[model samples]
Target: MTTMTPPVTPPVTALNALGFDRPAADTRVVVAMSGGVDSSVVAAMLAREGFDVIGVTLQLYDHGAALGRKGACCAGRDIHDARAVAARMGFPHYVLDYESRFRESVIDDFADQYLAGATPVPCVRCNQRVKFRDLLATARELGADCLATGHYVRRIIGARGPELHQAADPARDQSYFLFATTPEQLGYLRFPLGGVATKAETRAMAAGFGLDVADKPDSQDICFVPQGGYAAVIEKLRPGAAEPGEIVHLDGRVLGAHRGVIHYTVGQRRGLNLGGGDPLHVLRLEPESRRVIVGPRAALGVARLRVAEVNWLGDGAFADAPPGGWRAQARVRSTRPPAPARVLPEGADTA
Candidate 1:
């Protein structure tokens, strides 16, 4: 009888959340620490997994001014909390002073957009220019194979490389603020906590790791905008920015006086100070004439609107889509789900 030999099994390589098929010690990862519960949990989880992790916190605003400012990120307390988490996790940490860069990249742009009679999303701008853009570069220079964040957005490996998706927990989904994450940035970035079910789960994880920030409050406002006020900051940055303007009704009647067009936004209803027969809403802001144009709720409805600076991330090019345009899901605002949309390119710059 001939002896039979069993076939040998190939070694199974395990992949970490950062997607490296090697021991965590050999793969270096940079975690953007905000000293909040979510980010602190991310760093702690990676550290617990025996990864070679380096924690980096960005001081994006004035340290002195940010003291005792609760519910704000990238401030003095946040930096301290990040350092504490790193100490507990036994990982090296760094604090980068990015105040000037943030002001020019995000804060200034935010004020300018408001002055131009448009609502601005500074969180998106910060992610686009400061974190995903500048900070991602810093990670590469530090020899980090990947940069991980605590953001609530998913990155799935698809046929066409990495594809961005909403977080598993829809309530905590932050895909809107991250829509501008370029393909290149998406390739180098990872979100470890995106798959987690809820904030309570994150807090539990933080407690397990002995991180002090386990109970830290989530940041509620723009880090640079103290007490939820950006108008004052804008006025200080750009002297004479809040010039008086007229609030005019859609029917060409002057309704009231507005301090400035910057004080209002499209579709705003509150603080109009109009003694009216029926409730009115702001339809649009005319920056050219510094006017806040109001109308009935019907006028605020829009069948279509122009969106500029398109960033294409879907499969295939725009021209490859059907003649009528790509059948896709899109959201006009973050509060709503992406409904059915027929995206057609209006020009080179907009859709």
Candidate 2:
């Protein structure tokens, strides 16, 4: 008699916390450790949760030169701290030398943008070109199921797919610097600290995990440019970037001579050195004419701006926008709040 056997049922794999359809132990995650309390806490938390975690820190610059730098990240000291955290958590840690990549991608672009009279946010470029692009590639090469970071930006899986959202803690939200995150990168990236209510909470968790960076101060200035000295760095990158030029008023009157248009940005007031006149603010920077145009604060008001090389992270093709435009909220700077904006798609990548 042939006995009929019941078919073996396949176990369903529910999505894990990191959104992988498997158990935490089976999912390999790579945490981009910046040696800060926030990232260390993320690594520890994920390790405690039984996930196979690998800690990777990018030595973004010359380690010897970065040593003893306290207010910046990706330095020699940070790499050591990251390694220590990985050791404590019993996870494999690797430090990749990304100095050349950083210089070619982020640093060079920063200098060129200044020369072009445009204020460039190097952190955003670093994330867009190096960390999220190159480092994410490295993570995949390591066989990581996902790449996690300490960025205080939430990645929500909406009906469309993974959507970048502001962190639960608005004060720590890094959505501005992360605007360039592409959809494909969003799918593989996870931000574990996005839901944390506060930095204090992250510090407490780090302390609980016996991590060394529990009370470490947050990195303030750019990692490559120390002490917020943008002009000096620019000069070093491109000689004569700080060439002296005239600071002229909007009325076409020369107010005073100044050192380089790179030293000033639109809406600057304090460093003008006009001495005795109406409080003048930087109206615009003219790199070609080597001019720093100044005028009354009201002159700095902008009605519209043309943003180029736009990276659209919205639902559909940016070119497929409604005839009028898309009403949205836009944050021009990280320090400012989001304001209402009508994004008109001029082309595939501009609005």
Candidate 3:
């Protein structure tokens, strides 16, 4: 009788950057392409790594209106550029019509928020309501393992599960705009460029990979708004948004009149045009009364603030958190570094 030798198995490969314990060829990734270099480089890098990369871009607004609109992402020109990148990478590309959804979820809310006398970050709302929520669903329906974007934020595995951390690049860290990212969305999202040390490196990667968007400029804040005029767009969206309003001092004295509350924001100190000896800053806006309250810089300083609509990404259950609360670093603006913070949980939703 002949002795038969058993066949040996191949060595197993460890999990990938995306946390998938499978071969890149066997895994599928849906990339949200904004027709910008960062996202283009991501798709190219994954394609070069042998992963099944699918490029999807959203038609966020009217194609006719978006024509010739530069320095804006998700515009018609951006959509065309994204298609070119997909073609260059030799992958199947898709363009989803999200005009109606964008108008409802982002544009309308932006106007409403400004009309309500509040400073709104529309990028956060777009990510929360549109990309991470709605677009992520489309990725799942396509049988993708995960959805990825070019945001400069890290998603690392902590003691509990996936945790959101600031990107290594401090100058390019976009954590403030992403504070609304829910714990569930954190699990399925990947940020390849978060580990990058600089935006230059991203551009370098694009150049090395021969992507056409290597020299493309980054998108400005409020991509839908042209010329960075927040008030102009709001006025165009909602007629009479810039109605005349009384500019009143903190001491109940009328200083002057303003075009609209939308033209002013809290902490603003310039363009008062009051011909003043003492400088005045915008303290608050009362849309109901259509009045702009002006005061000194000292009035803008506040030690305590109650933040509604909180998003918790802690490792443990929020309710199980310590009574004294979690000690963490927090920032009020993206331009400033995080300061010491005590997070006292009042309920399951807020702290």
Candidate 4:
């Protein structure tokens, strides 16, 4: 006569049965509300779940002064809307002036990388330096346990370690822009809209909660460059960053001239004024010679890529691995699926 144990209930069900006991009820969380629908909903949801939510919006840059544009993310109107939403949700909100930091970390780096002829991803840098580093530190100083954002990606806590996965909504997956996020940071970060919530659903939730950003249009341009162009912004920031350079063919013959090395990137086909018989593509950018290399499209395909500042998720994926070894899914850019690659530890700085 053995006494059989009852089946264990799931945590979600147990939590609900216990009268919606919020996992973070007494925990203080700093929500990075970007005056967008998704972030606004995140704040509201956390508040509704009985957690102490504090909203902080980083005033990254002046859209009007920088790009002579308005009505984009991080502008005056967006800040007002975010503050209004925080008020409506009955939470404390603060706008942190991060203009200088943003310029140094994101804008300056972007311009410098472009001038150096490497395709720069500013959003990744922003997430790494601004949001996670600066904002996360602020949250800690404010006695908050964690930082939350409106990223459309999922962080799954696995037996081995935490892993970042694509969002339930495939269309809005932001994993690419978040590749720079470290594993330690993931432990302190939360994405409330990770699971299968479409943009329409998020907007509806905002409307239901009476958020001021319910009808706000999604920001399509870079938050700093509201006018939807980067060339002008770079020119203004670093006057000589866009010096005119020569466009050359694969055979080292000068084809024509280009505005600057900053104007081109890998896989770019347009604006190359080389009137040759065959269509030309930007094969490579030689910053040393200040020359734009144009050639046929077949030169772009490479089986290997070197990603600097590599951050691994799992435990010891390459602990005993040799240099130029160890296979893993390498995501070159965000939004694209991670492709199979042999990741080798190049060096401390060039991983």
Per-model TM-score, in order, reads 0.95, 0.96, 0.94, 0.88
- The true-versus-predicted C-alpha distance at residue 338 of model 1, in Å, is 2.5
Best lDDT goes to which candidate?
A: 2
Window of ten residues with lowest summed lDDT in model 4 = 13-22
RMSD of each: 2.4, 2.2, 3.0, 4.2
What are the lDDT scores of the predictions, listed in order?
0.88, 0.90, 0.88, 0.82
Worst 10 residues of 1 by lDDT: 341-350
lDDT of 3 at 193: 92
Model 3 spans with C-alpha error above 4 angstroms = 1-12
Model 2 stretches with alpha carbons more than 4 Å out: 1-12
* Candidate 3 lDDT by residue in tens digits, 69-143: 676898878888889988988888899998899899999999999999998888988999999999999999999
Residue-wise C-alpha lDDT for candidate 1, range 1-351, written one tens digit per residue: 999999999999878658988888888899999889888889999998888899999988886776787768878888889999999889999999898999899989998998898889999999999999999999999999999999999999899889899999989999999988878899999999889998889899999998888888889888888887788888988888889989998999998898888888888899999985899999999988989999999998777777797777889875566788888898877888888888888765478
Which regions of candidate 1 fall more than 4 Å away from where they truly are? 1-12, 347-349
Evaluation by TM-score, superior candidate among 3 and 4: 3
